[model samples]
Structure formats: C-alpha cells, structure tokens
Target: MIAKLTDIEALEAKGFDAAYPQKSPWDILRHQAETRPDKVAIRYLVDASDPARDEVVTYGDFARRIMGAAKLFRGLGVTPNASVAILAQHTPSAQTAIWGAQIAGRACPINPMLKPDHIAGLLDAANAKVAVIMGVNGELDYWSALVPALREAGVTIPLLACDADAQSPGADGVFEEMIQTASGKDVQPEGDETALAAFYHTGGTTGAPKLVQHMRLNEAHVARSCAIMHDLTERDVVVNGFPLFHVAGAFVYGLSTLSAGGTLIVPGRLGMRNAAFMGSIWQQVERYGVTILGVVPTILASLKATPIDADISSLRWLLTGGSPLPTELADAVEKHTSVPVRNILGMTECAGAIAVEPVHGTRTPMSCGLRMPFSEVAVFGETEGDADPSKPLGPDETGIIALRGPNVAAGYSDPARNIGTFLDGGWLVSGDLGMIDNEGRLFVTGRKKDVIIRGAHNIDPQMIEDALLAHPDVLTAAAVGMPDAYAGELPVVFAEMRQGSQAGEAELIDFLRDRIEDPVALPKRIGTVDEMPLTPVGKIFKPTLRAEAIRWAVGQAAEALGVEAEIAVDEKLSTRVMVPGESVDAMKDRLAGMPIKLSVEARS
Candidate 1:
C-alpha cells in the first residue's frame, strides 16, 4: 500500500513489515569488504588541483579505518550507549568519522558547518557525551572562539580535537593518541539493527530542526536503491563532490558508491576550481576508467558556467540531486559532455534515493523516476475530504509524498516533533510538496518549510539571522535568496541599525566573517529597512519578504538595463532585488490581467 499527501488522514502504520530483507547498511558494507577486499574502494584525489599525490583506499583498508576509528572512539571514554557526535566535513575524514561512529555504537551525524548556537542546540538536543571535533589545524574554528563557548555551555563532553598534528591545548584526547580508546573491545549497542542507525535533523515548518532517526533497515535500502540506479560495481570510480553532511552525499550517493567496492573520488570543494578538478577526475577515469560519478546541482551548474575542454568521454553516468535539476543546465551539460544526466530524489531519512531516472533513459526535464522495490508512493487529492493514504492517485494529481518501507526512519530524537512529522500510520510526512504522475514520475512541486536553497546549500533564513543579530549595531535582520543566473540563489540581508550606534554594510560583512565559517551563509548584500515584514503569528513573513525581494530584483533589472515601455519601474526603489524567474513583460502581463478577488472561506 502507498501513502501520499492527498489523503493523509487515512494512513495507518500496521500496513507494512518492520524487519525486512536487504536491511542494514553495515551488513552491506561488510559484505563488500568480504567479497572484494582487494578492490579499490575509494580513489580520493587529495587535492584535485594537485595531481601528483592522488590517494586511493582499497575495500579492506577502508573497512579497517572504520573499525580502527570506531575502536579509537570507544577507547577515549565515549561509551557505547552514550551518544558520540561528529560534524562531518566535505572530506574523506568526514566519511571515516561517520562510518566509524556506526561501528562504535550510537552515531548521529550533524552538519558541523552550522552556526555555533544551532550546533550547541543540536549537541544539547542529541545529549552527546563526547564530541570528536575536527582539530584546530584540522578544525574550521581557526579564528573564532565558538569551540571554547561550546565547552562552556555545559557541552562538557570530552572534546578530542583532530587536526593534522592532532594536538591542541584544552584538548581531552587526540584521535590518534586514543587509537586504543576502546582497545580490542567494542561497545554493544543498546538497540539491535532495528533500534536506530543514525539521527539527522531536518527543518520543520515550526522553524525548529527535527532529529530523524533512520533505522538500520532503511539505511541499506537507500544504499541499494542508489547502487542499482548507477549500476554500481567494483570497477566504478566515484567522485564525492557533495557535502558529506547531506543524506545524498553521506548515504545515498557516497556510501553506496564506496560499498560497491569502487574507487571513491573526493574533490576539495564544488566551486570555481571544479573544472581543473575535472582534469584530475579524467585522469582517474583514464587510469581506472572511472565509470560512475555523482554531482550536486551546484557543481554541475558551476561546471556549466565555464567551458570544459577535458574529455568527459570517460564518464558513463552523471547523477544529480539535493535540489531540482534545472532542465536548461542539464541540457547544457549533456550537450557539452555525452554523459546522460539522471535526476535523483531521496531524503536523509530515506537513506538513499526513492526514485532516480534510468541511465540513458528518456529525458523528462525534471522528472524524479519511479519508486524502488518494497517502497510504495502515491499522489492524493488535498481537498478530497478525508483521503486514503494507501491508495495511489490518478494521473497529474499533486500532493505530498509519504513512504512506508525498509528505507524510512523509525522515530525522531525529539519526542514532541515525532508526533506531527510522523503519525500513528508510521508514515513520515516528508514536508516536501511534490506530485506523482501516471507513469510514476515524481516532480518536486514546492516546499512546506520556508527554506532558501542558495547554490544547493540549505540556508534557513532564520539560521542566517542567528549570526547577524550577534552584531551589536545590527538591530534585526532577515536572510533571503536572491535569484541568480548560475548560482541559483544568493543570500541577501534586510537589517536595521541600532539607535545611537552605526555599522556600515562592509563592516557588518566583516563582522560576520569573524563569526561564521562559511562566508556564503552570511548575507552577501544588506539593506536597511524601517521594520521587518512579519506575519500575524510573529514569524517573519518570509513569503512577503521574498516577494518584495523578487519584485525589487525585477525592478532593478529593468532600471539598470532599461526594459520596454510596456514595463515601467517604480522609481522609489534603490536597493537591488530579484524576483522569481519570470520575464518582466510576463510578470507585468500577469498583474495586468488579474482581477482582485476577495473570499470568505471561513469568515474572520
């Protein structure tokens, strides 16, 4: 039985099996290690820019690192039952840390790049007893004192700083120093494979992040789902360009590729130098005939911006996820390189892809393909009045996507959030607004939560303001995604200055640079407003602000580069703003054609 958003009221949890075959990500990893121990598991291009010293790890060695790191964590007084947290970066060390956590016992991967307050909140929320922070030289906190403050906030968990040297004052233990943290002893997990594999917090409409408890079963299911789509094999050399913290980078795409006994490729970052890295990717492809590779939408878009002369002819597959696959960009890549671009849709809780277009399959612009085996999906009628979740909707109907299979989460870390996100039906509400077509293709329609995806990075506007407000002269600020041509969206800020105190835009930008690690997470452009746009509920009316931003953006575009007489601008606007991707004439015509309507669905 399949459940979707159309008729969510009718779903029930007793409809499916909890313990099914093809479960356990660890089981899959172990299987690959035993079967193809000699096979090259990952070919990490240390610095894609530097070709001379590319490193490779065999399946046997990769498995050993995981086990070794797991043992190391236990030996360091991070007990089995106690929560051990790691902020996974975009490097191979990130992968080792996550896999090691699972081997140790209870592991929950958190985005270490998040603001310190949120990091503190998540650490507190997880009740972590020990944190294996990336060390000072290895640590991202080179300038700021966020780490010290975290320790002060009762996050007195043993902090083992891990840099290249792995030595720093105030450090409880270095990872290498505690190679025998657990010695030959391994902590037995409190729950069996069915207990919980890991916890990942996702954004909710309530503006709070909910911790999703992915089960051991779904972990394997998502991995298999990804492995099958790309025809993952021991010969394939995979590139790990996406953020390891994201589900796509961690499990669905990253682990699945590694689990297949293939060569894993880790690029430094998905920015300007990516094309140069492609030369390195081509070299690995030529050296090992690297067949399969995964790319986030951001890197793909960046690759599209500058011309690539390197022969991607060695490329057999190009799978894209984390955001919608823009058709024009996808087409541009295919036109440049012969590799077919497949759109994949999966979530952190699902473990891997729920659906992915077949390789060399028919291109459908932005179609997220059919559901994997044992996983049922459907579309429902939103206003159908008590709709059935078990039944699939007919053609062209739009609704939320619900999943019931081995690949879904068991429960959440927070008990309160568990009730709303998941119901008595055992169906996780996926908050993503999407629709399934008659042919079973899923199209992501919209997001229920007001999140802004700027260059494939999930930046909650509120999450951004959490940093901006720290500036004494800054009264209040709002974070928004201004439309972009190649970048998709750029972060912008609407802020107010404090009375009797003043701060310039450049000064505020510098202040944020001191506080936040990822400069992109902070607002690129700042505008002072009399008052912030807010809803009656007091949550900043982000939608209204987004609209204003868009309108201002379109107007600026028109004013800077004059538009036709049919489209005139309101001269009162000084700040630059971007509208949703729409032509000026189209938007003007839309406004011109509309007749304002007032309704009383239920009188106020």
Candidate 2:
C-alpha cells in the first residue's frame, strides 16, 4: 500500500503501467481472492441497530458470487457485446450483478428511482439482453409498475428479481435461484482491456439520457488510482453508503477499496437513505472500525447535525464529493468531527474520478487536489460549446477544464453527442469551469451551463451560494438565474434553513448583502424551501431551481400586466407562457430581453 502522496509528480514517478499490472476489474478481484481468500471483502449490515445480524463475504466467496452472476448472465444469452441491466439498491446481490455482468458481458446499472418510461428508455438505449431488478419487498417495490411499462415500451428483455417474495409475479425468474443453477467454476472472464464493461446513463431527467461507455481499462485505472490516492490498505475498513448506479458508489469507493484488499462496509438496503442507518452511523463506524467514511455533501451536513454519541476515533478521513463542497460546510464538519475532509473531483465520463485530495496532503479549502497520475488535466479558453484543447490556459487562468487519460471512458454510446465533449486527440472536455494553481491544485468554479448571464456580464451562481451558505442558520443553499426583462437574467437564491432555526428570507438576504462584495452577483430575491431538491446521488438539482425561477419570473410579469398567466416548462426547460389575447404583445415585449425561447400565446 502507498504510504502517502507528498506530490503528484512523486506518485507519477512510479510509472502507471508498472504500478497497475491488472488489465481489468475482474483481474484485480481474482488476484485478491486467490491471495487472500479468508479476508473479508464486504460486510453488509442487515440492520443498522443490530451488529450481530451483519452478513460478511470473504474475498473467496465474493469472487465466486461474481463468477456465478457472470455464469447466470451468460446462460441467459448475455454475450460479450450485450448488456445486463440492473435496477436495485445497494445490496450484496446488486453488487454481484454489477461485477458479474461486467465479466460476462456489460453492466448497465439504472437508477431504480427513475420513472418506468425513463427506465425503459435507458434499457433500450443500452440494448440490454437481460435485466435484474430488486423484487417487491417491504422496504422497496419497483416491479409492479416497471414490468408493464417495459412491455408498453416494447422492451421484451428477460427479467430476474433479487430479494423478491416467492409469490411475486411478473418476474421470469429469481436471481438467487437462477444463479444457483449456474456453476461459478465454469465462468471465465471475457473481453480485453479496451472492451466495453458498462453503460452509465447521465442527464435523463430532462431529455434523452446519454450513455457513457466505460471500458475495462477505465475501471481498472480508477480503482488503482483511487486506492493509491486514498492510501487504502487491507487493514483499513471503508463505509460506503452510495448507491450502485452512481460511479462514485461502484468505482470510487466500492472497487477502489476492494482492489486494495480492504473491507467495504455497505449500509443496509436503503443505504444512506435509511434513517436508522444514518442515525446510528457513528456507532456502526466504531463497530466496524471504519477508517475511511465516504459521503456526499448532503450526508455530511446530516452527520454534522446528528450528535456524535459513539466513539468514532477510528475514522481518519471524511471523503466528500458529487457536488461543490461549500468551504463553510467542510470547515464546520471538520471542526465538529475532528476529521479532515478530503474533496474529490469526479465525473461519470471519467470512471468516477478526475482528481482526489490526498489523505496525507495539506487540506486546501475549495481545492480538489492534484490530478490523477498519468492523466492530463488542463484549462482552456471557453468557446461557444467546446473549448479548444490545443491552446491550454496558464495557471490561475479560470477557464474550461479538459482531461485525457486511461481512466476516461471510450465515448458515449450515441456517437453524435460526442462532438463537443469527446473531442479529437482523446481529450474529454469537462464542462466545468476551473483553474489549476501554480502548485497544481485544481479549483472548480462551476459548470459552464450553470453560469447566469446578466446582460454582457457573466455571473457565477457559486458566488451567491457561497455567501448565503456562510450564514450559520442556512442548511443548504442554491443560486440560479431568473429571467429578467432588461438584464437578460438576474441572480436568485434559494435556501433551506436549519431545523427550528426560524431564519427568514429577508434576514438571510440581509446577511448575504454584507458578505457579497460584487453588486452584480448579489441576488435579486431570496426564497426558502422546506428542503433542497437533490439528485439521487445527493447533488443539488439546479435544473429544478432554474425552472422554479422561470415560473416565478413569468408570474411577476403577468401580475404587472394585470392578466393571469399559465406557465409550462418542458423537459428542456423551455418556457411557454399563455396569457389573455390583449396582453400577448405586451407579454412578448416584456420578456423579449430574456435568453430563452419565450412563446407567449393567447389563452385558447
């Protein structure tokens, strides 16, 4: 195991090719199973409150289960080029399905929370030959609704259910029973390093999802890099509550810990969403002797609020990602838990990790640490849609970020979507705006599409968000652009207050007024919500906030024109405002300055 990473160059000196000899994820798992058969690979909590009920899987058993899963998929006609779609929570069976499908063919892990039609579209997009879904259980039930939707969508793939009731209908077979018929000894690894291993969908909530093709090499590269960067060892135990659908759960925390021969502790079926698990998470950490705790910003905030009733001295690092880690929140968490918070920069296209703050390195606020070894991360001048990688910007020059490395995915499944993102020369353009310092630390500003344009001036919503987050009463904050009649777009802030804080929007806006130095960046209005809308992976869902802002803007305009307006926002976030026939021209004139396809029509 790596002792520590003093510098990125020092880590790179140990040549990447020589350090990671494993060609695929299966190869790494096989090596571990052969070398340390008795070592615990996964410790699954059956109930967070009961330690004795935990189910443990040794490396030998885990490897065999993956092999069995592979054999099962292959027996069901899953070829090397076909895919095995998975729709389950963070359970042992789900883990098996993911790795096993990769070995036999390819794994397409879809979000179980998505609508049936969206799930069907993803299954169709991946060309899945078979699907394994979580069965109708007391805690979760997606089968009843999903089965008919797939049929309606004309998706006739075979369906298998895991953790299902014996009498559950609609499923062709049970995953556990079907796998028992297939012998693990007969399974063999298929595909080369460059072959496709998984199909991960991104951004399906708004429009058609883009399928990211992760090759075997990409997963292997990230596993090794993450293990080394996090200084993981067999002696360490990691608590990873992330879901399997996200790359952070599958690779960044899951495979990375196992690849290093460490024990991975998965929270119960509901994972972090389980209130009991989260309430007693500290006790569980102490019970498992967890050395590393992986969580998103939202979980971290919840942990900070939850009193530490148990001895958690074993935790060495609180690794957070999947969203911008507010410096204030990180500082608060570190102060409360006395554990250093290490930030990670990741994307699904890059197999989950682009950079990680070294466990032993100095903790720099707002910095995502050094780039991964053997990968090139550069910033370029922001163009219309794509940034030119040929001309890289200098240090401290804030611009668009681009990356190229073995960890990068081959490309999206839809080749047409690769024009701006997957460019020539193997460079994958990161839509995030960031800058590298002279010391090689990456500081991500925000997403390129997240910038709020105020006339000719470009305003970053992060500035407003950071200011609002500085308030002690604020629990979560997000900023978006509201359609403005004259300024094109104006900054608006949304906040979720801490429990029982009684913080009002006027008071929070007053607090931000003193903290914000730039006049243009100051929010025009502040709104409060019971809770912030978060993605399944726990990042703040900005699109929802943007849509709310547009609706609010249209309401204000209609009120001024003395006419009622009906606003409809489509999946693409295009707004259609229907008003009285007499006010159509006035409404169009009022909203003409906004940068959107504003369709103001007379109410039919």
Candidate 3:
C-alpha cells in the first residue's frame, strides 16, 4: 500500500500499462482510455430538471480533451517547473485543465469562494502564469473579481474562461473552443511522481492560508486507497457533490472512481445552496443508478428535513465527512433511508481523507474510522520541559494526532511552518486531538485549539456536544468555551432543534445533567438557534463561535464597569482589550483581577 520502490516498478508492467507509471494521477484515466475507450468516463448533469441535458463523455473523448489541454499549455510556454491556477466550477474542461497543468507543470486550484484580493495573493504566491475561471453570470461574477485580482497583483496571465455565458470581456479564448480547435496529437507523456504536481491552500482558520505542496504519487496513493475502501468496480457509478477545488471532490470522488474504471457523475456548479438540485438528489441517484455517494453532515441534515420518495436501493453507502456525524443523526438517517452512513476523517495536509469505514465492516458509533493502509497514525503528546515534544501516547490516551504516509503533503510553501510540523520520524502533526481505541479505531475528540480551559482543567467541547446530540429533540449541536470571570472559561452549548420539536434550554440542560456526570465537562449554558454557521466544507465554524463568546463576555464586563470595551481573540488565543477613558494599567489590573490574561490597548 505504501508503493515501495519495488511496487512502483511492478505498477508499470502489471497494472494498466501506464504511460508515466511512477504513480502519477493522470495514469488512471490513461489506463481507462486504453482498456475502455467507449465506456462512459464522466456523466455530468448540466441541468437537474432535464435528465436528457446530461453531458456524457467517453474515456476516449476525455483522453483527447486532456491531450488538447496539454498541447495548449505547452504552446503557451508552460514548463515542468511552472504553475497554473484554476478557479472554476465542476466542468470537463476545468478538470482536463487540471490534468494538463499537472502534466506540463503544477496545477494550483484556488477556491472560487475566496475574495478577489485573497485570490490575487494566492496567485502571486503560486506565481501562476495562466488561469482558468468561470465567466460572469447573473449568479456568479467570477470574471469580474478575477480580472481585478490579476491586475492588482501586477500579473499578466492569460485568462481562459470555461463557463463563458456571454462573450467574456477579458477571456483570451474559450476553453471548449480552444479544445475543439487544437490538435491533441503528438503530445509528450512525461511525468515525475516526486515532482510537485498540485498546490492547495489551507482554510487559514488559524492564520493566513499556507500553500500545501503535493506530489503526483501522494494523490494517486490516496485515490487507490479510497477505491479499495469503497470496493468500487466498473459496475459502480459514483457521484461527487463537493466542489472540484476540495480534495474530497477532486481526489476521493473524482480520481478514485476513474482508477477503478467506474463512471464519475457530477452536478455542474450545483452545491449545497442549490435548493432545487438538492431537492432532486434522490431522483438523480436513482436515475444514474449511483452506487456510491459523497456528502457532508449538513447536506445529510437537509436531506433528512426535506424528505423525497425515491428508490435508493442502488446506494451502497453514504460516505460523509467535512464534519463529525452525531450518532443520533446517523441512526435516524439509516432508519429513514435504509442506507448505511460511514464517517470519514481527513484534512488538507494529508491530501484528503486518510481514514474511512469499510463498506461491510463493523463501525463504532461516532468513530471516525480506522487509518488507511497507506498511512501510519499515532497519538502524540508534549511533556513539560521535555526536550522531545513529539512523544507518542499510548492507546486510549488523548493527544495530538500525528500521521506519516506517502499520501501526506511534502511540506508547506513556507519552510518555517515545516519545522515543528514534521517530527523526527517524519510524522506530520495534524493539530487535531484524537485517540485510538482498543480496536485501533480512530476517534477525533476535537481540535487542539478547540479545547476549553475551565479553571485550569482541560475540557473537550466535543464531549458535551455529543451528549446533547444524543437527545432525540436536538438536531445539531456545537459546544464552545465562554470567557468566565470565575471559572476562566465555561462550556456553552448551542443547538438547532428538529422542526416541530419543542425543546427548550432548561429541558436540554436537564438532559445533559443526566448524561454527563463530570461537572467540569458539563455545559454551563444552553442556547437554541435556528442554524449553526458552517465552513465551506460544512464543518462547524468554531472561530466564529469563539468571537461571539468573547463579545458576550466583553458586554458583561462593560455593563459591570459602566464603560465601553472592545475585545478580540486571535489564532494564538491571545486576547486584546480596548477601553476608552481608562488607563491601560488600570484596565489590565481589572482584567487580571478577573483571572484573565489580555493585552490592554488605550483608545485614541
């Protein structure tokens, strides 16, 4: 599974007769083209209302598109060391462009949701000489945002619009038109497995986004592992709902199915917000005979809310990630839909998901799953004053999760961030807290930064959240730490109730009191909300919760002191306080009296 040197040589001769057989991601489609040219490689839904409008492409056609893109890039002077940025939705041309860039140079997939200025900074960071993006529409104005970003960065890159609605104002050429005009003949098929092939930026939740460097083999290895876990075959049809910019969408759902010679289904530019498309998801699955489906917890919740009568007998399993799936919700979904839900755990640093529950294997409730065969996982902790901070913890002991594998990213763009990240044994610190159970199943407790310190005791918010989720009335729950004058920090729970369920704060509090025995771990306050703020990938946005808690704390302090105060918390958990008509020293003293450590800024 690690693809040793011996295995790489075997892969060339035994499997697929790959052109660039050092385990490059492109060889999957290449192999399929040779063996199954007439078979459907990609079946994309352009419009949900009309199934006849589905765009179908054969493996042979897909190969030609990839070659055409590669030819176009070479003509544009792209070299093996250069990089090309792609900022478009789910389309054959966009996907082909990614392969072409990887073959000729490096492919950088920028999240289209980012602001124009942020996109410009990333493009500058990657030094992209060319870009592919969607043109402006009534809904998405990607062209309008990208043009300014390119100009502001002082970059003169050629912009290729893949989804040009009307004639793009700044597009040098349309993607489809260029592919049709160019000859895909006489293209070189050279690839280096160790060479950097793609660059993905982190979510920047902790700080500014850092570029994650990935070699071709890293993606290929994980995709193979995913193929095995899903038990995919030529008979299987897989659908990807996640954006192509995400690792789950591109690598797990896209490349993995291709490796298995299975058809890949996509919904063009349709995301979780597309209510119409989402409403007809079951119908789409039945129409396509989709054997595998990828989703997140938020999407699952929405599907559960809006029930649709459709035959889902073809679905082998519901692969869910991007957030933790509560046991209660998982059971409810299975009971309602009769499809098993498998929880997966992964991060960008690992090139995508590193663990998944097997299709017909035993799954522990709320457990993320077992580590993939290609990766080495361990729980590590730091000891006070110990010279070596990367000491491994025993099983069932909570610590920072560490992983080392061929699937892991080579390193970050900034070498400084690489020091503490990679340990002496090549283990990459995951920054997530988890423990391995006796059965070797991985259980994610929470993020390292998400741990709440209540009167010097470490309290994991995930425990409280899980307890609340067990209640039948509770739909989705999130627990965070609220700054407290006495306890340093108190656990607070925010939940969204099931529709028509009349669960109040006191009722939830009493429910938790019966479930959680440890007082320190119990939520001090319970509040109900209509919905929880989620990240692009559908994970709970804890930073937003932390900021709201700080604001609430500041308001309470201001009311007590009869003065205005401003508060902010940064990624390092550093607190900043500003007070008008008060000395910095006086404010600091007052905060210190409340057992708080904060930097006081004087108001101008």
Note the residue pairs that clash in candidate 3: none
Q: Per TM-score, what order, best first?
A: 1, 2, 3
Compose the digit string of candidate 1's lDDT tens values, residues 135-234. Answer: 6653245313556767666567777665333356676776644643436854444455676667776642113456777777677767765675566777
Model 3: residues with Cα > 4 Å off, grouped in runs? 1-22, 184-186, 189-191, 205-209, 384-390, 449-604
On a 0 to 1 TM-score scale, where does candidate 2 land against the true structure?
0.76
Which lDDT tens digits does candidate 3 get at residues 300-388?
A: 65555557578878988887776556564566667768888887777677778767776666557768776766467888776541213
- The residue pairs found clashing in candidate 2 are none
Ranking by lDDT: 2, 3, 1
| lDDT (10s digit) by residue, model 2, range 1-604 | 3323346667678776677889799999999999999999999988788889898999999888888899999888888888999999888889999999998889999877666666787888888999999888877777877777777878788899997754457888999878767864566666579999999986432235578999999999998888988999999899888888888889999999999999999987888778888878888888889999998766776776778988999999999777656565677778889999998888888999988888878778778887888888999885545698767899999889889999999899989989888989999987888899987889886566566655323455776787788899888899888876546578899989888897777787788765654455678889988888998889898888888998999899889988999999875577899998999988876664454545889998
Q: What is the lDDT of residue 206 in candidate 2?
A: 25
- What is the lDDT for 228 in model 1? 58
Q: How many residue pairs clash in each candidate?
A: 17, 0, 0
- Candidate 2: list runs displaced more than 4 Å: 1-6, 205-207, 451-604
